[model samples]
Target: MNLESLLLNNLHRFPPRVVAWIEKRLKAIPSIRQKIDKEYDDMMGGLESSLKPYKDRFPAFTELPAQGRDRAEILREMEAMQSQEEDRWREGMVSGAVYHGDQAHIDFLNRVYALHSQSNPLHADVWPSATKFEAEIVRMTANMLGGGADVVGTVSSGGTESILLAMKTYRDWGRAKGIRKPEMILPVTA
Candidate 1:
C-alpha cells in the first residue's frame, strides 16, 4: 500500500476528535494546501471540455431572445449535430458512458422522455407523477438493500446533492458525539 492508504488506515483508528485535530493541523501546512488546490484545479480542467461542448459551437445567450428561434430551424440544427456526434458514443469511442447503439430502442426512449420533459419531482404539486416515480424508486432500492419497511431513501438529482447529504450526515453524527468539527478519511481508491 502507498503512503496515503497507510495514513488513512491509521487515521481511521483514531477517535473522530483526534482525526479532526490532525486534519486541521495538516491543512495549516502551506505545501499540503497548495498541492490540494492544484490537484482540484487539474481535475476540474479535465472535466470542463465534456461539460461545455456547445460553448464554442453555439451562440450563447445570457437572456432569452425577444422571440424564440424557429422550431423547425432549431430542430434541423439539432438533428444535424446529433447525426455527426452520436456515432462516437454509439460506437463506444467515449469513456464513462454506456450506449446500446440500437436505433429503435433509442427512438422509443426519446419519445417517452419527451412526454415527461416538463416533469420536476422537486415540485410535487406541479409534477405528482414524477414525485410518485421517485418515491417508488427509493422504496424499491431500500428493499433491495435489505432495509426494513420503515427505512426511507431519497432520490437526488446527481452526485453533488448526494455528496452533500453524506457530508451533512457525518457532520450531524459527529455533533451528536460532542465533536464540533468532523473529519472523514476515505481511501484514495474510493
Candidate 2:
C-alpha cells in the first residue's frame, strides 16, 4: 500500500494524545503550514461572495459615528436588509431556517419578543416572569414526552447552546462517575 494509506490505516492504533502531538508537529513545518493555510484561504474566498453579499451594498460601522444616525433612517436600512435576507427562508428555499413561516405566527412571535425584549432570564430574581415562563414551557414539554417527575431541563437559547449544555452535563456526569478521561463520538456532520 501507499505510505499515506498505510499511515491512515494504522493511525487509530496510536493514543489520541500522541496523534494530536504528531499532528501539531507536522503543522509546525513551514511547507505543511503554508499548504493548509492556502487551502483555508481558497475555501473562504469561494464562500466570501455568498456569505457577505451585503458587504458592498450596505455600510459597515467599525466604530460609532461622531453623531448618532437618525433612528428612522437606521430602522429603514435594517428593514430593507431584513427583507432582502428573509426572502430565501420565506419561500422555503432554505431548510430549517423557519419552522413556521406563516405571517400571523411570525407577527405573534414578534409581539411576544417585544414584550419580553428587556427581560433577562439569567437574572431570575429581577425577571421572575421570564423564569416562570421558561419553567412552564419545560414542564409541558417534559409531560408531552412522557417524562416522569425526575425529568427536568433548562431552556437554551438555540440548538448550539443546547448542544454545549448537554456536552457539559455529560462531561460532569462522567467525572462524577470517576472517569479520568471522557470521549464523545460525533457524526461527521456534527
Instruction: Please name the candidate that would achieve the greatest TM-score relative to the true structure.
Output: 2
- Please tell me which predicted candidate would have the highest lDDT against the true structure: 2
Question: Candidate 2 on 7-120: residue-level lDDT in tens?
Answer: 679878999899899779878999879988999999998899889888888788999899999999899989998999798887778876578988899999999999989999
TM-score of each: 0.59, 0.80
Q: What's the count of clashing pairs in each model shown?
A: 0, 0
- Candidate 2 Cα misplacement greater than 4 A, ranges: 1-35
56-157 per-residue lDDT for model 1 (tens digits): 887777999999899998998788778878888877887655546588998999997999998877789998988788889989999899988898778886
Error of 2 at 114 (Å): 1.5
Candidate 2's error at 60, in angstroms? 1.3
- Per-residue lDDT for 184 in model 1? 76
**Backbone clashes (count) for model 2:** 0
